[model samples]
Target: MTIIRTIPENEAVGEVAEIYADDVESLGYVPTHTKAMAMNPAAYGAFQALIRSVAKPLGLRRYELVTLAAARGTRSQHCRLAHGAKSLKLFDEEQLERIARDYTGAGLTDAEVEMMRFAEQVGRDAATMTEADSQRLRDAGFTDQEIVDIAIAASARVYYGSALQALAVDVDTPPTLGEPLRAALVDGL
Candidate 1:
């Protein structure tokens, strides 16, 4: 269990209850991360809005890929497992396994690889990034807007992932994730 004391689901009301309801409807259970964030429902709502805004223009596949890269860079096992399972909607098992193992050799397009690398770098070290980094994304065929979106997606992940880590939230392994891919993300091999 997390060190934080969250609103218990049974006693939840108002925004917290609503948040729990939405998760229960979509995910079939309330995620531990959701419960942790719901300690401050308004802040949690704002965070969700930020994620939706970033995801809306980028599309699900791109967001998940960028998120996975960011999670990997930060070594956030929770985000990695969660997003890795979400990525299964877009990629086959073999391809996802390959991406988890090594995305460079996973047969992704050059543009895709560049964006993931950029997202990883953002999570790993944003301060060290220079204009040349943005230029690399541009060279990879991304527009300024797309590059900005990728950065936001990656940076936002650091915020969320850091919160989970700080609270020592338990990693929720989605059942949809296969063993090999799970092992790769969780075990880092």
Candidate 2:
């Protein structure tokens, strides 16, 4: 059960409602994490901005891969469900299963796999990352700017992951999220 009651879509008002409205129109639904974050307007705004900034440059598919790896590493049910749902729409069922099972085994290109690995390391322990980690990403062809963006994405996941876990948020199993992906999100939770 959720520690705090999430504001339902219909019940939201003012800025929260506006945000939800936009999300619904764009993504076909307001994700549960977004609703939970609406508990604090400033945090919700920051979350939205961070999502846009990190995701827009890479586009949605790669962003979802990075997010899935981060969510898995963080063991954040909320992000797992939410991003898993989005990922389903971007990748085929087989590819989604691969990402959910083990992104490295998912036939990701060498560079993309490296990116996901970097995301996992940063999500699990940002402080432990050393020059070797940076060098590995650099060797994989990720530019300095892309590496910084990946770090920013991982930082955003950490912030949101902690919030979702602290809130004891229930994972939402949207119909569009699909059974396999849903199972993956709730795995070991």
Candidate 3:
């Protein structure tokens, strides 16, 4: 059970309901994470806005890759499960398995692998990131804007993963995800 009471979509009023409705319409279901976030409407709105503003401009695939790396580095079951599900659409079963096992060997382009590595580094040790890290990303073809957006994406997962863990929010195991990705996230949990 969740530590924080999740507000039902029907019980939410005004903007909350509106946001929930749109989410449900887009996703075909209201995610438990969103409901948990609804406890603080302002925070939820800001978070949702940040996700859209940062992620939409970048390709969803790239953003999802960063999210996956951060989720793995942080060991957040919720993000690992959720983003893994989304990743299946972009990667094949064998590729997803490789990513879950070891992203470095997942057959990604040099730029993508470098980005994931950078995201993991930020997630694990943000303070330790040096000028060389930034230079590496720039050399790997990430522009200044993209680097900033990558940081935002990684930072967003820190809050999101921690909140979901604290709330004990259940990770949804959608049928589309199959077994490998699910196993990757919920294996020890």
Task: Highest TM-score: give the candidate number.
Answer: 1
Our tally of clashes for model 2 stands at: 0
Candidate 2 segments whose C-alpha is farther than 4 A from its true place: 5-8, 27-31
* TM-score, cand. 2: 0.90
The residue-by-residue lDDT of candidate 2 on 1-189, one tens digit each, is 677787888788999898899878877887776788888988788877888997888778778877877777788877777777667678887777777877778888888899888888877888888989878889999889788877788778878998878877766666676676678666723
Candidate 1 lDDT, tens digit per residue, 1-189?
688888888999999999999988877888788889899988999988998998999899889989989888888888998888778889998998888878889999998899899998988889999999989999999888888999999999988998999999888988777788899887752
TM-score of each: 0.95, 0.90, 0.89
Of candidate 3, the 10-residue stretch with the lowest lDDT total is: 180-189
Ranking by lDDT: 1, 3, 2
Best by lDDT: 1
What lDDT is reached at residue 184 by model 3?
A: 60
Error of 3 at 50 (Å): 1.3
Q: Which ten residues in a row have the lowest lDDT in candidate 2?
A: 180-189
lDDT per residue (tens digit) for residues 1-189 in model 3 = 687776777788987797789777766777888788777889988997898888987689899999988887778877887788778778887788778777778899999899888888777778999989878889999999998898899889888888888888887765567786678655522
